[model samples]
Target: MGNDKKSELEQWLEALCSDPFSSILDETVFRVDVFETETEYIVESELINCTKEQIFVTCENDALIIQVHENENINKQRVVHLPFPLLNKNIRAYFTSPILEIHISKEISANHPNRYMITIHEIDL
Candidate 1:
């Protein structure tokens, strides 16, 4: 069952990255980090030109921690713990700063493929 879930997640991620919307911000600079543990994985992303835009983070089977920082100051922090097993869950964190930080953690099964993905969308000011 765990392997199946992971496979589904991988497929979803592939499709997401293949989508035309995924490459819409190629001109912008973004940073993505994927960290893996024995039973969990962490994904962190820092996006530029994200002020006044809603940042979305998704995971398959764990909790989400989002922190917003501006000018080296912490603006807002939110943690969401999901109950049910996530096939694909989307959580949005709003930021009004020039720089935005997003962190996501999810449980990873040994039988499942380990991967993380980050997507950014530009919102109208």
Candidate 2:
């Protein structure tokens, strides 16, 4: 199939580098996709070889910071800035193996902390 004809999952998989080892040695932490709908913004991050327990997410001001760790020694961090100011309560996240999906609502759920850890729900996919 042509590039435009590919499914989202297929495109996502293909978007991942064919050489997986180089991702670790290279500066890029992981591949990320951010898109918006009428209701919310979706943040999808490809967290390769990482477990739900190894990932940490925090909402700080206008940015969502993702921290990943394979162990005490190996750590990687990525900061995703929001298109608009959002509260922590408006954010929800799920972890399914190599993909961590975060959904941010356009409307505020409630006033929460300026900096707080977001609960990561493990969903079978």
Candidate 3:
């Protein structure tokens, strides 16, 4: 098999492993990192050149949803699902220039069986 053409599978695999982050974020949503400490979950995101009114955050069914309303036609949405339950009321978010950080308090109590939608949290940039 000297210098023969590569199979379709080989090409697909090569593309899959190359620049994985770019492939993941084909949409307009910003990338984020969510990590857990002993007492809380920290969500870090960077929204450069974005105002406080353009950003929205909420939690539902253990999922943290972030929406950046750019325009009427183009809105970016990102969601992060928590492994364990979190206290919705205790959740807090902060914004300093380009950085948007969210802190969710860890909840070890009984889970809320009902699905509830939280009010849109507008970050103060």
Candidate 4:
């Protein structure tokens, strides 16, 4: 049973990598790391060239917590603790600048048998 689950996860990751939207993002400009704690999901990211820019991070479900740190002069940071577990499996975040844009999305679809879509948009901030 464990091997089956692992195989399923592998296939899903491959599909995400081949997604059209994934191809357009600047993979070098943003970094995402997921840390699993005993009861929460910790997602940390470092967004480059986004200091003074408006950052928007969202997840499909409202249960996951968020913490953001801006590498600016003042060292701005924000932490949001979610009320429940994120079950939608369509988490995303967007950062926009006058000349550059960054968007990140995880969990393209739910763990169910149906297909779902996750979209990210970046506009002038």
The 0-to-1 C-alpha lDDT of every candidate, in the order given, reads: 0.43, 0.77, 0.64, 0.40
Worst lDDT window (10 residues) for model 4? Answer: 98-107
Q: Each candidate's TM vs. the true structure?
A: 0.33, 0.73, 0.61, 0.32
* Backbone clashes in model 3: 0
Cand. 1 TM to true fold = 0.33
Residue range with the least summed lDDT across 10 consecutive positions in model 2: 9-18
RMSD of 3: 10.4
- Provide the global lDDT of candidate 3 against the true structure: 0.64
Lowest lDDT block of 10, candidate 3: 111-120
- Better model by lDDT: candidate 2 vs candidate 3: 2
1 or 2, which is superior by TM-score? 2
Please state the error at residue 38 of candidate 2 in Å.
Answer: 2.0
lDDT of 1 by residue, 1-125 (tens): 56456654455556645756434522333433334445444444555544543454434355454444566665544433334353343323333344443422354223322223335443335
What's the count of clashing pairs in each model shown? 0, 0, 0, 1
Q: Report clash pairs, candidate 3.
A: none
Regarding lDDT, does 1 or 2 come out ahead? 2
Supply candidate 1's per-residue lDDT for 26: 28
Which residue segments of model 2 deviate by more than 4 Å? 1-27
Q: Which pairs clash in the backbone of model 1? A: none
